[model samples]
Target chain A: MKLEDQRTTVYKVDPDHPETESLPTLRTEELLLNMGPQHPSTHGVLKVILELEGERLVKSTPVMGFLHRGVEKLAEGGTYHQFIPHTDRLDYVCAMYNNFAYCRAIEKLMDITVPDRAEYLRTIVAEVQRIIGHLFWLGTQALDIGAMTVFFYTFRDREILLDWFDELCGARLTTSWYRIGGVEKDFTPSLFEKLKKFLEYFPPKIDEYVIFLEKNRIWLARTRGVAVISAEDALSFGLSGPTLRGSGVDYDLRKYEPYSAYPRCEFSVPVGKNGDTYDRYWIRVEEIRESLKIVTQCLEQIEPGPILADVPSVTLPPKDRVFTNLESMIQQFKLFSQGFEAPAGEIYCGTEAHKGELGFYIVSTGGGNPYRLKIRAPSFIHMGAFDFMSRGYMIADAITLFGSYDIVMGECDR
Target chain B: MHAIAEKIQEKFPAGFLNAQEWRGDLAITVKREALHDVCTYLRRDPDMDCDYFVHVSSVDWPDDEERFEVVYEVYSIRKRHRIRIKTRVPEHDCIVDSMTDLWYGADFMEREVFDMMGIRFRNHPDLRRILMPDDYTEGYPLRKDFPVQGKGWRDSFDFLQDPN
Candidate 1:
């Protein structure tokens, strides 16, 4: 019999008296399916092994390390100043936050205080980077769930942010704009004007995306009540960022730790009632609105001042000073050749990256380079819950479950 | 932070090694054998309540008598304070009790430690090489003795030559 005929005949003769019929019983075995170390929906090179009985997943395991570059080992060999570029590649989508987190970790270890104006500049750029990171996630996630229009709309705004990044720094994507003391250079007057305009224009676009996705019949069936994780299980699994907040856990690192200019701002962290895919989606959208409010506040508060702190050995001197003064020239050469010495200690600094709590544990042995640097990447820990979350769900709905975590594999495998 | 450290010392006197504070974070080193009991007490005790498991990683200190120091970072969500629990494992006995029963999140973090730092975990349900490939027979990449550029794998790769 043909494959279609076999399936049809088994169902047709089995309703009233299955034992009385002369047909053999249909046997189904667990099927193993490999879903991409290279698929488009995975966001990066993440491979998942699925064992399914018919269409329902029996067991699932996420196999990572395809994009592993041994970032921790590289940190052991390089100077503290040289490691800033390495952080840019960890969470490449929100590159500015990676730079900020790593630099802040070093600053905390050495007890270096950032200047007042530099703190506000770091705050403004970091929030703008948060929107860019969430925008990329929203576009790709909506496309994965079969909504094509949001991808176009989100990317259209993301281009404007990227262009602004290029104008501020030299590059767009992997911008090493943040330095150890502060930002590389202050935002120009025109760049500040552009950021103010973007803050004004973005709130209505968020409403438009929400309007398009809120009542769509396909979006409702796909996301509502799908891949539900309770508040307690979400906490025990070590989930952070918006994924944990979606479960009604009010543990925003910004609100809890109050780093940088976050303590001065008067924005609210949105919490979800139901821990589902729709809640996570709603959390990111609401967060963008809150981030815009912070940017508007920063624009009014920012004042003109020196961008970099006046730390002698750590912060790089100005270009004019390096050209004219001999002492400044020697200081620049010594910093690059041998990084500044740090007191022997270990500290783990966790920042509210766009994805989650991006933690960096640096162990220095009073040397120029770190003795050991372990990155507590949020995506790596988030992937551990894949087997627990995806069990007993249809294999087709696995995409929705994976999409809800908002994981980027660069940080996962690093 | 000192109160919690004193509480653990009062409960298990022999298990506590010493407590050190750096940059306002408390780090308490404990005996390796008593780690499971200490962790369980920290999780269940109402005053301690270190419910959130931040991460579990190991640092290679080849010069020390106990060469590998396994570090566990935990935070109390309700109390809003953090602490570090450090336990040393000798080079020969690199196995530590797994916390998979306590927190579901430690599953892969322990496996990654086993894969990279060559540490093993007892009572772990699924212990295998996670980040490295299945057939990989090379030494642990994160160990102090392992060369950063790698040994023969890069130079022996045949496809690196020009095809034309």
Candidate 2:
């Protein structure tokens, strides 16, 4: 039996049941409760102002911006390269993907082309990050909704991915591994070996998760058709990533825009028939399987080449250049001091990460810094769809619906 | 080749649709003020169903007289082409027509523009603070004109002087 449908003695009231009288408007009973800004299952510091009708949420207005560090504004204060490190913190869970998105936008404005090898490397890291991100979502969502054991099993494998990330960059989560020109380095040999091993072993482990939840009758009854959002409604709300695909839109940035060498990589966008909590859950789980495919392809196809592009002014010269030649020393000084200059035009670049379409709209005035950079985070838009879906469902399903959306609050507030 | 820009070019012959480019899937552009008519045509015109409003975001351009440029990323899943419409509003008159009637998705996005940029949306329903606190009325945060680090942080626990 589902934990939600089972009567828990928290409030001694089942407000969702229509057979019970509509909640009374007694001044003593009605308490205006704050759900988050710190509470678990809110995903991040998402504060929801939920007015209670005696245990049932009558009106819920999501209050954001507690975590807003004026990122977009702070970006304007610094040079173009200075903003790259800031992007790492926007969506801390998927830092590489954020780095990729911000750099791609600047590249678009500057009219620079990334090397094929760098694109492939980005794809490998992006897909792996997607797997890691979705696993975090599935684990946390399940645990938040009462399936506690999923977290234990899910984090065990999550550590393996984080270990690979730590090896790639010094830090596990905030991997500032991308500059404007390309990635920090090519996929190292030791890292590649472990990833190849992971690609081989992770799929069956995903199936283990499926066997635990997908077939369980209680999990199905709890999720299936709980909060149904049609393709039309989802599109209207600007939903993307797994949330849009879960509703069977089949519009993924990887498939459509084909950025970061996604066209060369072989991975199908798994879509759903019905747009519900169950479909959203299944789509993410299936995406983990598909991301593994992309990762394997990227590993096999990676070429041994310089990770940074031929552009020395925009890209960092090797540390060897710092010690070796006079001209190389001058170039390194210019790059660090003046930073890279971009053309005077605006360009927007988006990619399919763990989230739907993460886009960066960058406007340049031919200077070393961006004139303006607007981040179109998918979670920020996806969070708007909450009221539409949560209207008829029980209050408990709010946690499930919010989790199924897979929002990272840092990005949303940023 | 998207029809809305083409139609826009034909309709306002002189200087309505300035420049249009198809970046992958979206028909992106730079337009000054005819946003109201362009969006109306996108929805009413049978050829373009851009009926589904995907997202709307604002970017601050501090140097230019036109300080804030709001970008509207729209989509028509029925026809399958996305269009990004843009407009630049001076800091004095940040007010713009709300597209909530055309697509309900614009509701929150408009509120966001109101919240962050302090750009007033004329006809939005619940246009109170969405991101910032209801008590906050000092200045717009997203605008490049806004200061990053103010002399507001307290060294000690100044209980009476919390700015946030």
Candidate 3:
């Protein structure tokens, strides 16, 4: 039987009613689907309520704060020096950037200038962290889009960098190597050699990872033209880093407001024409290459000098000095116990992290502990535009949207 | 004074209270009633094109007459300049105009301020708790009076109780 005839026979027309319709209409309603407070693709504990009309997403409400430990509130309770470790937990995946950003903010507040060598060191480590962050994002985002081979390839290279971080600092993931004035220690000979070798080995690996997804039909279909936002909307929504640059708005804090060793190094910021998932992915990959170039330049230009800024009131004494000299021991003790007094003012300093602009706004009332500390976490701000971008996209693209923003729940909820 | 601050002061003399520049950051304090107008001017004016919304933060000053200070930091992508627009509201009337219409990104940021500081936004479309749970009945967590250890609600939860 024909489909129309079957439908007509299924719903028998009422002969008694003169105005009976020819076919019965199917009742349709929007489906409310919850995509995860615990789902693996969310990167962290993040819940998004997706309103679906069939397969298309009508609206999405991101229910954040599953990982809220009140890092800002905790900052109010600790001294300025004590808060360094606390920042390590903000963006757990890329803790070095958080430390760099927080320490940069404090340095700005105190008007401390880092030495040239320290600046180069900070930039090198920060770029390495950027590479790791992009690798983590690439691996997980490809896995979310159903390409599994790229994940293994990307993570394989990521392991080397993590091991480098382990040798650089004692810890691998939560390396608090950055301090208020400068880096904790200088690069050793072995560390320098390993970094130089990795710099040569990394470019081909990037090409290998790209080969997996560059022409894969499924990857192209899944990422291309997905979650497209205009340049105007992106700026108005305060999107930054690759997410903002993907929309063709060249608003990089490193280039616009140069800081650290970025001003000294020569590198290009990659921008995309079409603001979509594919463009964002391309921007991240290009950024990794640019970061490698930056690291190489820093290595070539670096000169032997003091790593830490010798500011007695603000910076800590060296470990050797602290153990041998009583005055140095007293200085370290006083710094850790009482904390250096900060000026009674407020300042906001922004750093260009791998994900986006990580800014710290500190309010000091001439005390050791900050009166109020506000973190302008990019992941949290990007979530604001979730419903607008996710609308009209497929329900499955929800995971793609999350991956594109590189939304870490720890920073989002902080 | 910053050129933008000077322009804001010239445009809204009655609304403008003071301007402070410290550490290359320009902060302007405006009357609470004129907060929206000042931000609108900042957004629409060609010379003061502060289109990028950075963040919305609130500070509690328990001792002051106006107990809550609302801060809205904005940057102009084209101009590459930043401005911090601040306004004060008393504890009894802890409300400010919403900037969601001007900058769509302010939706979540203002909601966060409302959630943490208990300062309401007048025309915010969705002014519910963002980082905190919706059903949370305790006071705002960012308030100074709110204990750092929290309200001990976690200890009082039914999950912690032993099933007899």
Q: Scoring each candidate complex against the real one, what DockQ results?
A: 0.54, 0.42, 0.55
User: Model 3, B19-88: lDDT tens per residue?
Assistant: 9999999999999999999999999989888888999999988899999999999999998899999999
Cα lDDT for residue B73, candidate 3:
97
Give Cα-based local distance difference scores for all models: 0.87, 0.77, 0.92
lDDT, residue A135, model 3: 98
Over A207-302, each residue of candidate 3 has an lDDT whose tens digit, in order, gives: 998999997999999999999999989988999989999999988999999999999999999999999999999999999999999999999999
Better of 1 and 2 by TM-score: 1
Can you give the lDDT of residue B110 in candidate 2? 89
TM-score of chain B of 1: 0.94
What is the TM-score ranking, best to worst? Answer: 3, 1, 2
Pairs of residues at least 3 apart in sequence or in different chains that clash in candidate 3: none
Query: If the candidates were sorted by their DockQ against the true structure, best first, what order would they fall in?
Result: 3, 1, 2
Candidate 2 per-residue lDDT over residues A282-384, each given as its tens digit = 8899888888888788777878776777777677776687789888888788876677777766666777778878888776777777777778888888888
Candidate 2 ranges beyond 4 A from true positions:
A1-31, A52-57, B1-3, B12-17, B20-33, B51-54, B61-66, B78-80, B151-164
Deviation in angstroms for B150 in model 2? 3.3
Looking at candidate 1, what is the lDDT of residue A370?
93
Highest TM-score scorer: 3
Indicate the docking level reached by candidate 1. medium
Predicted candidate 2 versus true structure: per-residue lDDT over B58-88, tens digit per residue: 8777787988777887766667667778877
lDDT of 1 by residue, A1-414 (tens): 122211211223445775647666766566778899888889899888887778988888788889999999999999998999999899888899999999899888988888878989999999999999888888888889999999999999999999999999987889988888888988888999999888878889998888878878888788888888888888788889888899898888999998888888889999998988899999999889888989889878878888888898788887689999999999988887799999999999999998899999988899789999999999998898888888888887789888888888889999
